[model samples]
Target: MIEDQLTEDDVLLPTYGPRPVTFTSGAGSWLTATDGGRYLDFLCGLAVTGLGHAHPVVTQAVADQAARLTHTSNLFGTRPVLELADRLRRTLGWDDGRAFFCNSGAEANEAALKLARRHGKHADPQKVHVVALDKGFHGRLMGALKLTGNPAKHAPFEPLGTWATHVPADDPDAIAAAVDDRTCAVWLEVVQGEGGVRPLSEEVLAAARAACDDHDALLVVDEVQTGVGRLGEWYGWQTTTVEPDVVCLAKGLANGLPIGAIVARGVAAKAFQLGDHATTFGGGPVVCAAANAVLDTIESDGLLAHTRAMGSRLAAGLEALAADSPLVTGQRGRGLLRAMTLSGDFAPAVADAALRHHLVVNAVAPDAVRLAPPLNVTPDEVDEALSRLRAAVADVASPTGASPTGASPTGAAPAETDGR
Candidate 1:
C-alpha cells in the first residue's frame, strides 16, 4: 500500500541494505509502515531508541530547544551542553573527568583514540600501539576502523592506520598477551554488539584493567551500543567490577538525535588541551537538549529498573524457546540487547520471516539474530514477540533441515501457559 511516489530519491548514502518497508511513524515499541502495517520493532534503530520512537519527552525537548536556539558554534557556551555534561558526569560517577562531544559513535570513538594517542605521546612517543578485541566493532571512520578488529571490514581499507593489535574477546590470557609497555590504549566493548552480542567476562575485563595499569596504558570502554539503559545501567562497564579510564558513548545518548561523547577520567582527562579537539555540531543546543531530556525521562520514569525487568523477561522467553529447539544453539547478552544463535546460517531467513510476521529484528552475524527492543516494551508485546519468533524459527528450521542435534525440525514448540 505504499504510495507510488515513495521512492529512495533523496537517499544519497549506500551504507545500508534496507528492507522493503518504509516506516512513516512509530510509537513505543511499534512502527507504522508507509503501507499502514504495524510492526513490533525489536531492532530499536540498533539500540538507539532507548525510550522508543517519538518519545514525548524527547519530542518536547527538541521542539522547545529549537524554538529557543538550535546551534551555537563551540565559540560560545550553551546552557544545554553544560547541563547535559554535568548530568553525564554525575550519572556515570566519573571524578575529575572531561568530555568531548561529536555527532556520532564513530566520532566519539575517533576522539577517544586521538586522546589515547595524546596521552601516550605525553608518556612516551614509543607507547603508540593500541590493542583491541577480535571481532570487536568500534565504528567506521579511519581511526575508529583502525581500532575495530574485524578483518573483513578492514581489508578494503587496509594501510589505513598503524599501531593496532587484536586479541580474542573474553580471553584474559589473550588480552594479557597483547598488552605491553608500548601499548597506548586497550579498547573493548562491554558486550560485543556487531560481533554477535557476546558479553566480555568479568575476569577478562579485570585482567585488561590490570594489564593497562601495569603498562601505563589507557583502558577505553566503547559504550556506544551498551550505554543509556540498554544494558540495565547508565553504562555497561558499570555492571562490571573493572572501571575504564575513558568511555565512548552514543546511540541512545540523545534518543535518535546525533550526539557522541568521549569521557576521560583521572590523568587521562588531561590528555587534550583547549585547542587539541573541536567539532562544529558536537554539542549543539538542540541535540544537548534532547540528550538532557532523555536522561531526565529515563530517571523520572524509572526506565532503568524497567529495562532490567523487561530484559529478563525477554531473555527468559528466548532461553525457554532455545531449550527445546535444536535450531537455536545458544543465547547471550544482557538487558534489552540480546541475541540467539542458530545451528546454521539462517539469520537472514529468520529475520525475513519475522518481518513477514510484522516484527523487526536484525541479523548481527551469519547465524545470530539480535534483539534490542525498546526498554519500555510491554509484557504483552514481549509475549506476542515470543510467540511470533517461535513460529518464525519453526518455519525456517522445518523447510531447511533439522539441526545437528537430531531434534525435530520444528525444534521446540511455544509454551501453552499463556503468560500474557
Candidate 2:
C-alpha cells in the first residue's frame, strides 16, 4: 500500500498522477518496487533504457566518471565528450557533421531548430518558417513545442508563433504542399512514438527529402525515441534511404542518463559558428562517459542484432495475442518501438490489467498501447510479457465490465501522448 504521508504534506509535484508503487532498484529487464515485488518493465522509461536497467557497463561508467570528473562546463573541453562525438560521427558515417550536446531530448531539438533558423538566416533573413507532421512530437521547450503537431498540447499555448506549418504523416503531397522557399526546416520522426508508434512510409520520407532539397530547407530527424539501436539501427533513418541534414537524439543515448545531441551535416554544421549557441550542462563529463560505455557495450555485445531478433519475437507475440481478441485491431512500428491498436479506446484498461499481472506497459494514445522494451530483453522475458498481456486483454475484454474479483474496472483514459 502507498503511504499517505505525502498526500498530507503535499511535497511532490502535481504534474504526474503517479501510481502507488515506488521502485527501489532495477536490474536487467525487471524493476523491484518498494514493497519487494518484481515486475517486468516493457516501457523502458519511454524508450530511454535501451541496454536495460542497471546495466553493468553503464553503472561502472557512471561510477568511474563520477570518481574522475563530473562537470567542467562547455567553456572548457572534455576528452570523453570529444571521443563520444567522434564515435557518433564515425558510427553514423557523417564525416562532415558536427555535434551539439544538451541535457535532454527537448534541448537537443531546441538546438536543432536554432541551427535551422541560423542556417536559413545565412541564406535569407526572411526564411524562418518550419514544417512538421501532425501527430508528431519533438519536445517541450517553446521552439521544440512549436514544431509539435498535436493541437491539444498547443491549444493552451495558443498565439504561439505561426512559424511552423503542420502536415499529416505519410502524405508526400501534403508535406510537399507545406514546404516552400520561406521554410527554413522540416522536422519529423522516422517512427512516431508518442503519436501511436506509426512508421512513416519510405515513399513519404523520400518525398520529404526531395521537398527539402527542392526548397533548400534543412531536414531535421527527431530520433529521441528511435535512436541508439531501438529501431535496430544506430539512427532510425539508416533503415530508410533518406538522409537528414540534422538529427536529434537522446532517450537511449546514455541508457537512462540524461543526454541529448544535435548532429548536423555539411553546410548545416557550419551554420553555427562560435558564440551562436552553447549549453553549460551539454556533454558534461559524466554523462558523456556513460554514453561512451553505452556505445561500446552496444557494439561489443551485438545488442543491435539482439534488438532486431527480440523485436521480431515480441511483435509476433503481440500479433498472436491480437489474433484471437476482438479488442486488438492491429500492430504497428519497427524493431522494439511497437504498438498494439484496439478496436476501441480501451488502452488504459489494458495497461491496468497488465499492471495487475505485474508488467509495466504504457498506452501512447487512446487506442494504442506502446511497448518499447529494453533492446536487450530476452526471448523468455518476451514470452512472459506475452502471457501477461494475453491475460490482461482477456480481463479487459470480459463482458461483465468487472475484474474477476468483482471490482469495478478502472476507467482512466490512457496517458496523453507524452506531450509530443
Candidate 3:
C-alpha cells in the first residue's frame, strides 16, 4: 500500500516555492519551529509585524472585539472601524483627511488608483495617465500592478494598459518631463522595498511634487511597506521634503492582520464620494480593533523613539560588519529598513546561509540582504541578530572557515526578555 502523503504542492498552489521550515509559534523577535528549534526573526514577515508576533495588546484587542462582534459588513457602522479612521487621520496630521479601508496593500493601491482616475475623469477625462518611477513596487492587483515600475512582474500578465509611464528613479528631470496635462497622479515609493531597497533622491521627490503641482495632479505615496513606524517615523513620506495628497498603507498597520487603508487630504479627499468604492471585510471590527491596539502600544510604549535608537545600533553594527568583511560593500537605507549591500550578486546564497544559522532575512535584491526587525526590538536582540548574520557571512564568504566570528552555527540561546 502506498503512503498517504501530504505536501504543499498536493493541496496548495505553487505561487511560492516549497518551504524548508515549519514554524509552530512566535513571540516578540523569536520564532519556534516544529522541531522546537528557535530562530531570530529579522524579516518580521516581510516587514508586516512591526510589533512582533503575538503581542499582548493586539492579542487582547482581537479577543475582546471578536467576542463582541467579528464583522458586520460595510453597510453597518462599527466603533472600532470609526475610531481607526479617526486615529489614522490624526497620525497623518491631516485633519481633513478621509480614509478607505481594504484588505491588503494591493487593494489600498487599487482604491487609490480608482480615486485618481475618478479625480481625473471629473476634470477632463483625458487626464488619466499616471507618472511612476522605475523600480517602484505598489502592488500586484491589475491597476496597482500597472503603476508598479518593474517590467519583470508585469511580463507574466501582459495587456496591463498604457496609462502609466515609468522613468528612472534618480532622474529628477525625467520625472518632471513625464508629467503633462494628461497625467492625473504621480506614483512613488520613498524607499523602494522590492526594487533593491533604494531610497529616492530628494531632488527626484521634489521634482515629482513640483510637477504634480504644475499639472494639477495628485502625488500619491505608496507607504505600504514604510508605514506604521517601520522607518522610525509614522510614515516614510514624513521624513521627506515632499508632501503627498494621498498615501496607501498596509503591512504593519495591524501587525500580522490583513488590513489596508488609504488616507487622502485636501482635494484628493473629495475625489471619492459615497459608494465610490466598498469592501466587505475591510473595516471589520476585529481587524480595526487590532490596528487600534497596535497604535496604542506604539504610542504608550514609545516604540518610535526605541526604533530610532535601535536603528542606530543596528546601522552601526552593519557598518562594522561591512568594514571587516571583504564581500560586503557597505549599507544603504535609513532607520530600521536597511540592506547589507554585497560586492557580488550573491544575496540569495547569503540569505540561505542566514536561514541555516537560524536567522530570518531575505534578499530584497540580487546584491542586498534586507534586515527589518520589529520596531520595539531590544538591544540584546539586535546584537544577537548581528552576531548570527556575521556567522552567516563567514560561512558563505569564507567557506574555508578562516573568518573570525562570535556566534555559533548551532544557534545560540536567545535573550529571555520578550517585549519592550
Candidate 4:
C-alpha cells in the first residue's frame, strides 16, 4: 500500500533530485522497481553494498542481534562491538590498532579530524592545520567538509574554518609543500570515488607518508568506499607502497547497515584519551554484529581474491566496449571501483539512458561514468551489466537520438554539470 504512494519524492527534503525509480525488492546484483522491472545494479548504492542486496550473512546477523540486544550506549561494553573492533584490527594487520565507531563515513572523518587536532595540540598548540588533496571527497559534516578538497561543496557553506589546505592530488611536490610543522593530518582516498573514480599515484602516497613522518602529522586514509575488500585488499592503502597511520572506513563495512569507524595504530592510536569523542548510536551491537558478519563472509567466501578476478573481467569488458564504442575514451580505477571516461561531458545523459535500459549506474563526474559493482559480483552478472551498458551507450550515441543536455552526440561537451 505504501509502495503505491511512494512513486514521488515530494514529501522528503530537497537534498536529492528526483529519484529515477522506487525499488521494492532486491537480491544480489539486481533490484526490482515498482513497475516490476529488474535492473542490473552496477553502482552498488555508490559502492556501499559490496556483498549485494539482502546478503544472507549480514541479514541473518542483524536479525539475530536485533532480536537479542540492540543498544547499550558507549558507556557500557557490548560483545558485538568489542568483537568487531578486534576483527577490524586483524583485517588491517594492525596489532596495536584502536577503532572509534560512528554512523557514517562523514562521522568517521570528523572523529579523525578531532583526533588529529588533539594529537597536534598535545605537541604544539599552533599545529592544527590539515592537508588534503584537491577533488577528494571526505564528508558532508562541517568539520569533514572543511577537510574535503572540493571547494564547490564548500562555496554555499563558506567560511568553514581555515584549518585545511588543499593541493593537487597527483603532484607529490605539492603534497610535500603543503605539509609542514604546523600540519596535524593529511587526508586522502585511495580511489577518489566521488571524484570520478580517480586513483592516486604511488608517488603521492609515498610523499604523504614521508611528509607526515617529517612533520609529526597523521596520514589518514579515507577508505569509506574502498575498504573491506572493495579494492582487492582489506584496505586501499595496502595496495600502495606506503601505509597510513589511520584509516576512515564505512560504506561496505556493515554491508548496507549505517556504520563507520576510524582504525588507528602507533601514535595515532593513542591520540584519543578518555572523554575525548563519542557517539550515541555508534558501535551498537546490531550494527557491529552486521559488520562482523560482513567480514566473516568475506573471509569465508574468499572475496578479496574473487574481487580481483572479477575486476579483471569487468576491466576487460569495459576496454572491449571502449574499443568498439565511439563514446568511450578510456577506463581507470583499482579493482571493482572503476570509471569509463567519455570523449565529452555526456556521462549524465548516458547514465539517464542506462536507467531507461534497466541498468543502475551514475556519472561520478561530467565525463566519467563510474561503475562500482558488488565485491562478490559473479562473472555472469558482470557480463550482463556490460551488455546492458553497451545498449545504453548505443541508445545515447545514436545519430537521430535526442541528447538530454542539448549537445551533439559526436563528442561535443554537454552542459558541464555533475550528473549525480
* Residue-by-residue lDDT tens digits, candidate 1, 1-420: 665655565454644544458889999989999789999989888889988899998999999999999888999999999998888888889857778899999999999988998999898988889999998989889888888888877888889767899988868998899899899899999999988899999989998999999999999999999998899998999989989999999999998999999888998999898799889999999999999999999899898899999899988999898997887877789999999878866676677777788888877876788999988889999989888888878867775533332233345522111000
TM for every model, in the order presented, reads 0.93, 0.95, 0.94, 0.97
Candidate 4 lDDT tens digits, 332-372: 99889999888877788788878888889888888888898
lDDT (0 to 1) per candidate:
0.86, 0.87, 0.88, 0.89
Candidate 2's residue-wise lDDT over 1-420, tens digit each?
Answer: 566455623777665665546789999999999789999999988899988899999999999999989889998988999999998898789998789999999899999998999988888999989999998888778888888888878877877898999998979999989899999899999999888899999988988999999999999999999999998988899989999999999999999889999899988988888898888889999999999999999999998888889989988888887889988877888889999888777776677788789899887886888899998899999999999988888888885543432222244433333333
Q: Write down the lDDT that model 2 would get.
A: 0.87
Higher-lDDT candidate of 2 and 4: 4
lDDT tens readout by residue for model 3, 1-420: 233367788889877765768898999999999899999999999999999999999999999999999989998899998999999989889999999999999999999999998888888889999999888988888998898888977998999989999999999999888999889999999999878779998999999999999998999999999888888888999889889999999999999999999999999999987788999889889999999999999989998889889989998999899999987888888778999988766676677778888999887876788999999899999999999989888886664432122112232322111010
RMSD of each: 5.4, 2.7, 5.8, 1.7
Candidate 1 CA-lDDT value = 0.86
- Determine which window of 10 residues in candidate 3 has minimal summed lDDT: 411-420
Report the C-alpha displacement of residue 312, candidate 4, in angstroms: 0.6
RMSD, model 2, all Cα superposed?
2.7
The local lDDT score (0 to 100) that residue 149 gets in candidate 1 is 80
Q: Indicate which candidate wins on lDDT.
A: 4
lDDT of model 4 at residue 97? 95
Q: Score candidate 1 by TM-score against the native.
A: 0.93
